[model samples]
Target: MSFMKKHLKTLTIALGCSAGAFYLGWQSPTLMGDVFEQQQVAQPTPRFYPLERFIISVPGKEYQHYVLLELALKSSSANAKHQLAEADPLVRNSLMKMFAGKQVDELNKPKNLEQLQQEAKDLLTNVLSANKFAVKIDDVLFTRLVIQ
Candidate 1:
């Protein structure tokens, strides 16, 4: 009974501190969640810049073939469209060269088409980087694709 009386004050203080800590911890996630939501809201939306249509003849063993492609570049930059306009010729030439090398069979499969989209994105990013352009491409989207 004497020992309990001696430690009672210390135990009460410890319990009070623990309760306070638990209360703060319980509230922390709500505060942190609000901060995260605000950050997400502050982030810029992605912008897309469409390229002119491309009609290229593909060399074949027997008959002539062609591919019609329409592409759009996705970026977070506000000036992506203007920058792409400046680099349009080079972009078209690079894509044309890439498509020119593809056979009809290579472009026919759905799997191949997805691969081609990724390839185009990487290729455009490289082209923009090589030219020292300020624009960064996030993705390449094919708005239209026709092969015949």
Candidate 2:
């Protein structure tokens, strides 16, 4: 009974100190609002721009092959996507030229396709920046690729 009484006093004082610290450390609504705003400013949302299907013909050894490609691009700027849409014709023309030059055997390889996607990304970034577009594409995703 004596031990219980002595420990109870220590527990009560500890609780009081913890309660006081918590009360002092609690944030106000304005401070919380500022914290949330900082988090939002630090992280920006991603944006995607999808290009339509492209049917390109490349000459094979015995016959001409048809390649179907669909591309989606990712970036952080809406204005860049808008500019890409506005200059769709020029972008398509450039990509078509690149695609038309690929050999059917090369396109059939998975590694080559990955290289193609990377090349497309670099090419698109260069073209957009050179054309004075608002944003450059960070990635190129091939949603579909079929060769026939």
Candidate 3:
């Protein structure tokens, strides 16, 4: 209907103008105001933290390399030590996975290494997030990913 089309056009114009105005205001630091504070509520609660990097051996390999991840874990040193003590098998299984889900090209290509690393991180995050209680790892990183 013509009426519907007109109302839609008006609504679109109003929304676009409002968005442009908000963007301009944000760019002008002098106009920083309470809106920023109100927007803060949309953010997620900050509890994820990165754990320290570790070098774990890969299957059929005789060497070890440091792996990094973009996880949100805390350095509860005592808790980590205790948990590892209690769940050594589970820990080993998780670490071994870093080597399992890999292709030689992905690990070897310097140009595509970033994409590979991101994929690894996403994979590890999905795996760890499933176990938010005991074997909880916020993310994974690969600091020294050498295939040797």
Best by TM-score: 1
CA lDDT of each prediction against the hidden true structure: 0.87, 0.84, 0.51
Score candidate 1 by lDDT: 0.87
lDDT of 3 at 95: 50
Please provide, for model 3 over 1-148, each residue's C-alpha lDDT reduced to its tens digit, 9 standing for 90 to 100.
9999999999999999999999997776556655455454353332433334444433433444333333234323334545534544444466557655554444556887666546555555455456552444333344455554
Clash counts per candidate, in order, are: 0, 0, 11
**Model 2 Cα lDDT, one tens digit per residue, 98-136:** 899889998899888779989988888888778887786
Worst 10 residues of 1 by lDDT: 35-44
RMSD of each: 4.8, 6.5, 14.5
Model 3: residues >4 Å from true position, as ranges?
A: 1-92, 134-139
Better of 1 and 3 by lDDT: 1
- Ranking of candidates on TM-score, top first: 1, 2, 3
lDDT of 3 at 144: 51
The Cα error of candidate 2 at residue 113, in Å, is 2.2
Which candidate leads in lDDT? Answer: 1
Worst 10 residues of 2 by lDDT: 35-44
Q: Assess every candidate by TM-score.
A: 0.71, 0.71, 0.36
